[model samples]
Target: MSPFVIAITLSAAVLHAVWNAIVKTAVDRTTTLGLVAFGHVLPATVMVLLLPLPNAESFFYILLSTVVHFGYFFMLGKAYQHGDLSVVYPIARGIVPALVSLWALILLGEVLPAQAWIGIAVIALGIQLSSWKVLRSGVGKAALGFAVGTGFCISIYSVVDGIGVRLSGNTLSYWAWGAFLHIFIAGFIGLRKRATLAALPLRVWALGIAGGLVSMTAYGLVLYAKNFAPLGAVSALRETSVIFAALIGLVFLREGNWKRRLGAAVLMAMGVALIGTSA
Candidate 1:
C-alpha cells in the first residue's frame, strides 16, 4: 500500500478508538449507540443528496452491510455492558484480520505476501496479550460471546464494504449510502428508546452524535483505503485500533495492567510497521 493509504487507515484507527471510548463512557450504551447511528444518518443524508448514487451493482452489498451492522451495534453494546473496553475491544477486534483474509481469499480471490501474513499473526498475538488479564480474572461469559460475535460482524462488513465500494465506482457515494442506511438502525433504536431519548440531556445527545460522526469518518477512511489496498492488509492496518483502545482504556478509563497493555501496544505497532512496509 502507498503511504497515503497507510496514513489514512492509521488515522482511522485512532478515531475508531476514540469513538469506542465515547460509547464505553456513555450513561446508556444502547441510546448512545442509537445516537451514534443518528450522527451517521445526518451527514450521510446530506451527502447522498449532493453526490451521485452508487452503482446498482453495489446496492446489494450495501443492504447486506446494513443488516450486518444491526447485529454489530447490538452485540457491541451488549459486550460493553458485560466487560471493560480494553478487554472487549481487543477480543472483538482481534480475530478480524484472519477472518477478513480468509473471506477475501474465498470471495475476492485476493492474496497477501508471507510477510503480510506474519504481520497479521503478530497483531493477533498482540491483541491477546493486551487482553491477557481477562484470562486470569475471567471476563464474563456473556461478554466473551458478544465480543467474538462483534468481531465476526466487523469482518463481514469490512469485506462487504470493501467489495461494495469497489463496485460502486465512487467511494463517497458508497460510504454515504452505507451510512445513510443506518437510518434504519437509528430509527429502530429511537423507537425502542423514545421515552429515554426524550428525557436525555442535550449534553448526552451531543456526545452520542459526536461519537457517530467520528465513527462515520473512521469507517469512511477505511473504505477509501480499501479501494487501493487488498482487503487483508487494510483490515490488519485498521485493527491497529485495538492497540489504541487498550491505551485509551488504561489512561482515560482508568483500567488496570499498564505494563502488559503497553508491551502489547508496542508489538502491535511493530506488526503495523511490517504490514506497512511489506504492502
Candidate 2:
C-alpha cells in the first residue's frame, strides 16, 4: 500500500479506538449504541441527499452490511459488558485480519504475498499479547465468546464493503448510503431501548453522537483504502486498531499492564513495517 493509504488507515484505527472507548465508558451501552447509530444517520442522510445513489449492484452489499452491523453492535455491547476494554477489544479485533484475508481469498480471489501473510500473523500475535494476563487466567468465557463473534461479524462486513465500494464506482456515495441505512439499526435499537434513551442526559447524547461521527469516518477511511490495496492487507493493517485500543485502555480506562502492552506495541510496529514493505 502507498504511504498515503497507510496513513489514512492508521488514522482510522485511532478514531475507531476512540469511539469504542466511548462505548466502553458509557453507563447505558445499548442505548448509547443506538445514539451512535443515530450519529451515522444524521450525516449519512445529508450525504445521501446531496450525492447520487450508489450503483444498484452495491445495494445488496449495503443491506447485508446493515444487517451484519446489528449483530456486531449486539456482540460488542455484550462483550464489553462481560470484560474489560483491554481484554475484549484485543480479542474481538485481533482475529479479523486472518479471517478477512481468508474471506477475500475465497470470495474475492484476492491473494497476498508471503510477507504480507506473515505480517498479518505478527499483528494478530501482538494483539492477543495485549491481553495476555486475562488469556492466561482463562476468565470471562462469555466475553471471549462474544468478542470472537464480533470479530467474525467484522470480517464479513469488511469483505462485503470491500467488494461493494469497488462495484459502486463512487466511494463517498457508497459510504454515505451504507451509513444512512444504519437508520434501520438505530430505529430497531431505539424501539427496544426507548425508555432508556428518553431519560439519557444531554451530555451522554452528545458523546454518543460524537462517537457515531468518529465511527463513520473511521469506516469511511477503511472503505476508501480498499480501492487502492488488497482486502487482506488493508484489513491486517486496520486491525492495528487493537493496539490503539490497548493504549487507550491502559492510559484512559486504566485497565491493563502497560509493561505487557509496551511489548505488544513493539511487535505491532514490526508487523506494520513488514506489511508496509510488502506493498
Candidate 3:
C-alpha cells in the first residue's frame, strides 16, 4: 500500500473506534443506532439530490452492499446484546480481514503475500485470546455465539463492499448512494422494533449523530484508499479497529482484564508490522 493509503486507513481506524465507542455508551442502544441511521441518511439524501445517478453497474453493487450493510448493523446490535463490547467488537472486526483474504483468493484470485498471511494469523490469534473468558459468564453463551456468527456476516459485507466499489469504479458516487440505501434499510429495522425516535439526553443525540458523520468520513477514506492497494491489505488495515475498539472498551467501558488487553495490542502491532513489511 502507498503511504497515503496507509495513512488514510490508519486514520479511519481511529475514527471508526471513536464512533463505535459513542454507540457503546448509549443507554438505549437501539435509539442511539436509530439516530446514527438518521445522521447517515440526512447527508446522503442531500448528496443524492446534488449528485448524478450511479450507472447501472454501480447500482447493482450498491444494492448488494445495502443488503450486507443492513445485515452488519443488525448483527452489530445483536452482538452488543450478548456480551461485553471488548469481547464482541474485537472478534467481529478482528477476525474478518483474514477471512476476507481467504474469500478473495478463492473467488477473485486476490492473494496476499506469505508474510501478510502470517501477520493476519498473529493478529487473529491475539484477538481471540484477548476476548476469551472463563466458563462462568454473565451473558448468554448462545447469544454470544450467534453474535459471532452475525459479526462473521458483517465481514462478508465488508468484502462485498470492497469488491463492489472496485467494480463500480466510482467510489465517491457509490458511497454516496450506498450510505442512503443502508440508512433506509436500518430505518426499516428500527421502525419494526418501535425504536425509531430519539429518547435520550441532548448530549447523546449530538454524539450519536456526529458519530454517523465520522463513520462516513472513515469509510469514505477507505473507499479512496482501495484504489491504491490490494483489497485484502486495505481490508486488514481497517480491521485494526479490533485493537482500537479493545482499548476503548477497557478505558471507557471498563470491560475486561488488563493483561488480555495488552496481549491484544501486541498481537495487533505485530500483525501490522508484518503486513507493513510485506507491503
Candidate 4:
C-alpha cells in the first residue's frame, strides 16, 4: 500500500463515518437513506453525461454490486431499527475487512502482507472493544443478525467493485455508472414510502442529500484506493470509520461510557499507525 493510497482510504474513512453518523441520528432512517440515494443520482446523472460509458466487461460487476448494495441498505436499515449506533455500527463495519481479505485471496488472488493482516486484526479488535458494553449486555437477536448480514453485503460489494473498477479501464466512468445505478434503489424505496417521503421538510431533504454526497465521495475514494492497494488492506483501513463513529456518538449524540469508547478509539488509532507504517 502506497502512502497516497493510504491517505485516500483514510480520508474516505472519515467521510464514511460522518455520513453514517448523520443517518444514525436521523428521525427517519429509511426515508433519509432514500434521499441519500437520490443524492447519488444527481451527481451520477451529471457524470454520466460528461463521461464515456464503462467497458462492456465491467457491466456485470457493476450490476452485481448494485444488487448487493440493495441488500446492504435493507439490512442496514433493519439493523438501525433494532440497535444503537455504538452497537450496530461497530458490528456492521467491523466484520467486513477480514471477510473481504479472505474473499480477495480466494477469488481475486490478491494476497496481503503479514503486517497488514495484523493491522486488520487490531482494527477489528478495537471496533469490537468500542461496542463491548452492548455485546456484554446482550443485543437483540434481530439486530445482531441484520448487522452481520449488512457486514456480509459490504464485503461482497467491496470485492465486486474492486474488480469491476479494475476491469473498467476508466475509474471515473465506473464510479459514475455505479452511482447512477443507485437510482433503482432510491426509486424502490421512494415508491414504498411515497407518502412519508413527500412529507419530509426541506431541512431533512438537505441533510439527506448532503449525506448522500459525502457517502458517495467516501466510497469513491475507497474505489480509487483499491486500484492502487490490495482490496483487503484497503477494506481494513476503511473500517477505522467505526472508531470515528464511536467518537461522533460520544460527542454529538451524547452516548454513555465515554472513557471506554475513547480507549477503543486509541486502539484503532494504533492499528491505523501500524497500517501506515507497514505500508
Per-prediction TM-score, please? 0.95, 0.94, 0.90, 0.93
Candidate 2's displacement at residue 212, Å, is 0.3
Per-residue lDDT of candidate 3, residues 196-259 (tens digit):
3534568877877898888888888888877677777877788777678888888878875767
Candidate 4 on 30-122: residue-level lDDT in tens? 998888888899999999999998899999999999999999989988888887676677778877877887899899787767886787788
Q: Which of 1 and 3 is the better model by lDDT?
A: 1
The candidate that wins on TM-score is 1
Per-residue C-alpha lDDT of model 2 across residues 83-158, encoded as one tens digit per residue: 8887787777777877888899999888767897787788778767866665789767788889899999999999
Candidate 4 wrong stretches, greater than 4 Å: 272-279
lDDT of the candidates, in the order given: 0.90, 0.87, 0.73, 0.85
Q: Residue-pair clashes per candidate, as listed? A: 1, 0, 0, 0
Candidate 1: clashing pairs of residues: 1-279
Candidate 1 error regions (>4 Å): none
Model 3 quality (TM-score): 0.90
Winner on lDDT between 2 and 4 is: 2
Error of 4 at 93 (Å): 1.7
lDDT of 1 by residue, 178-264 (tens): 999999999999999999999999999999999999999999999999999998888888888878898899989998777877778
- Cα displacement (Å) at residue 108, model 3: 1.8
